[model samples]
Target: MIRILFTMIAIGALTSAQAQTIESGSHSTTGYIKSDGTIENSSHSTVGYIKNDGTIENRSHSTIGYIKSNGTIENSSHSTVGYVKSDGTVENSSHSTIGYIKNDGTVENSSHSTIGYARGVKKEWAAVVYFFFKF
Candidate 1:
């Protein structure tokens, strides 16, 4: 079951930029993931960024973490923090399932409860920003 779940995450290279809305489970607008990788609050204030190279940065441009090409997530110190698997299974450093990013962009907790949504956004980005709160 774990293997099957891990296989479901859609890992891939960063594609062309397209702005996407981020919403809470209740469907309230939370923020926006912009074409240029800027993360903004509903008020349109810059909050963070997700670079094309998978580098996560704060509003101040400090390195926060990384979502690697092969689905490995690393902290600024370059330590393995967690992973957003190819199948959308989000696991901690210990490799235990914590959440999931569904194909339709629905974010779910380990119990499979809907926690948020990131429609039209890349699963890895959605997982990091919405699920992991990396930025």
Candidate 2:
């Protein structure tokens, strides 16, 4: 199963000149931004978000890495990018999702899911399943 690496909360807002506002643990409409108001780096445990003019990226788990808008979530060692939705869902990149995922170390930034697999999943989606075939 995937896990959280790091999470940092800064109780301040960065100016629009060099950065934007990032209210730690604020479940409001606006999320947090980096010092540049564009680029976001991992503080630890949660997600590092970038201001894309819409949809404030809440948090991701990664260590000593950077974030880009071209749909890329990078990590070093056991770091990962976590996902959170409006309906209260948390997804990580390390989870195999179903049974097709392994520790190949190539997970994408998907919502409430692991980047390894997306096959034979339930339509309703109750919980994360890990199936092992018996030979």
Best by TM-score: 1
TM-score of model 1 vs. true structure: 0.83
lDDT tens per residue, model 2, 1-135 = 122222212223223333322221222212223343232322322244333322223344222332323322333332444322223233445533321222221122333234333222221111111111000
TM-score of every candidate: 0.83, 0.24
Please report, in order, the local distance difference test score of every candidate based on alpha carbons: 0.84, 0.27
Give per-residue CA lDDT, model 1, range 23-74, as digits (tens): 9999999888988788988888899998999999999999988889988888
Q: Tell me, what's the RMSD of every candidate? A: 12.0, 17.2
In model 1, what is the error at residue 107, expressed in angstroms? 0.3
- The TM-score of candidate 2 is 0.24
Candidate 2 achieves a global lDDT of 0.27
